[model samples]
Target: MKKLITLAAIALFSTASFAQTTWNVDKAHSKLQFTITHLAVSDVDGIFKDFTATIVSSKPDFSDAKVSMTANTASVSTDNDQRDGHLKSPDFFDAAAFPTLTFVSTGITKTSANHYKLNGILTLHGTAKAVVFELWYRGTITNPMSKADDAGFQVTGTIKRSDFGFGSKYGSPMLSDEVVVKANGEFSKAN
Candidate 1:
C-alpha cells in the first residue's frame, strides 16, 4: 500500500512539471496591427513591424497563461512614407523619446470555451495604463513544416489615445481618439 501511494505521488509531480510549456511567437506568421478613424470619415490602418511576444502556460487549455509583448515605436508603418515619418515624430508616438511600447498580462478570465478576457498593463508614450482585451485561442495543431506543436491566437481591443497621453492636439475630427487594436499570432512550442 505504501508503494502504491509513493508511485501515485511521483506521477502527480511528474505531470505537473511536464505541463508547463513555453511558446514563442512565429514572427513570419504573426502580425500586430491597429486602425484609427481618419478625419471622422475614413479609417487608416497601420502595423508595427518589429515586435516580439511570448506565452507561458501550465495547462494544456492555456486557461492560466501569461503573455507579454514588446514593440518598437519607430517600426510603426502605415504604408505611406510621409505619414509613417510623422507618426514617429514628437506630435504622435514620439518614437525618439519613447523608443518602445510593451504589454504584460496581469490576469486572465475565461469567458467561453475558446475565448477569454485578458487584462494587462500597456506602457506606451511613457505612460502605463491597465487595459483589457478579448483573447481567442484559435487552437493548437502539429505544424507540418516545423514538425512541432503550434498554437494560434487573436486579440482585439480598443484604447483611447488620450489614455496614454499622446495625440492630444488632434481631436476626434482629425484623428479619432479611439484606436482599434488587433493582433494575430502563431506561436511555436519551444522544446
Candidate 2:
C-alpha cells in the first residue's frame, strides 16, 4: 500500500507539470497599440512602450489560458508632452486613480477555424467592464532567436471613454467619444 501511494504521488506531480505550460511575454515581438480621435478628426496613434504579460495554457487552443498584463501608465506618449500630460490628468485616464489597465480572460470560445471570441473583464480607471475582443489565431512557429515555440494572435475592440468617466475634458468636438484598442501579441512557449 505504501509503495502504491508513493507511485500515485509521483504520478500526480508529473501529470500536473506536464499538463500545464507557461509562456513569458516576448516583448520584442509583441505590441499594444491604441488610436483615438484628435480634435474629433484624424486618428492619433499611440502605444505603450513598456508592458509584460504571462500566459499559462493547457492546450494550443488556449482553452485554459490565464493571462495577466501590466502597463506603465507613464509610458504613454503621443509625440506631445502637453497632450500626454492632459491624458494622464483627471480629464482622461486619471492615471493617478488608475495606474494601469488590465484584462483577464474569463472564457475563450471558438467562433471559426481561425477566429475566437475572447471574453474578459477589462479594468480601467477603477471600473471593470465586460469586454469581448475579436481575436484571430495567427498560427505558431519556432522562434529563430529563442528557439522556442511561438504563438501569435491579433485582437481588436473599442470602448467608450465616457464609460470610464473620462468625458469631462473631452471638450465637445475636440476629443472623440470612443477609443480604439489593438493588440498584437506573441508568446514564447517555455521549454
Candidate 3:
C-alpha cells in the first residue's frame, strides 16, 4: 500500500509538469511600439529598443497564463534626435530617474479562438495603474532551424498620457492626451 501511494504521488507531479510550459521572448522577432498625436494633427511614432517578456501557460489555448514585461524608457526614439532627447528628459519620461516601465498581468480572459482580453498593471514614470488590452494569439509553430516551438501574439492598447504624468507642459491643443501602444512578438519554448 505504501508503494502504491508513492506511485500515485509521482503520477500527480508528472501531470502537473506536463500541463505547463514556459516560453522565452525572442527579442529579435519582437517589437514594442507606441504612437501619440502631434500638434493635434499628425502622429508621432516611437519604439522601445530594449525590452523583455516572460510568458508561462498551462495550456495551448492560453486560458490560464502569466505574462510580464519590462521596457527601457531611455530607448524610446521618435526619428528626430532632438525630440528623442527631450522625451528622455524630465519634462517627459525622466528616463534617468525611472529607467524602466513594467507591465504585469493581473488576469487573462479568453474571449474566443485566438482572441483574449488582458488586464494588467502598467507602471510608468513611477506610477502604477490598471490597464486593459486586447490580444490575439497568433498560434504556435515549430522552428525549422532550432527545432523548437514558437508562439506568436499581437497586442493593442491605449492609455491616457496625463494619467502617467506625461505631457503636461504642452497639453491638449498642442499634444493629445491619448497614446496608442502596440506589440508583436514571438516566444520560443524554453528548454
Query: Model 2 Cα displacement at 121 (Å)?
Result: 0.9
lDDT of 1 by residue, 95-167 (tens): 9999999999999999999899999999999999999999999999999998999999999999999999888
Cα lDDT listed for each candidate: 0.96, 0.80, 0.91
**Candidate 3 — which pairs collide?**
none
Q: Could you tell me how far off, in angstroms, the CA of residue 135 lies in candidate 2 after the best superposition?
A: 1.3
Q: Which stretches of candidate 3 lie over 4 Å from their true place?
A: 1-14
TM-score head-to-head 2 vs 3, winner: 3
120, model 3: CA deviation in Å? 0.4
- For residues 105-179, what per-residue lDDT tens digits would candidate 3 score against the true structure? 999998999899999999999999999999899999999989999999888999998998876787888888999
Deviation of model 1 at 170, angstroms: 0.7
Best by lDDT: 1
Candidate 3 TM-score, C-alpha based: 0.92
Worst 10 residues of 1 by lDDT: 13-22
Q: Pick the candidate with the highest TM-score.
A: 1
RMSD of 2: 3.3
Is candidate 1 or 3 superior in TM-score?
Answer: 1
**Candidate 3: residue 168 Cα off by (Å):** 1.7
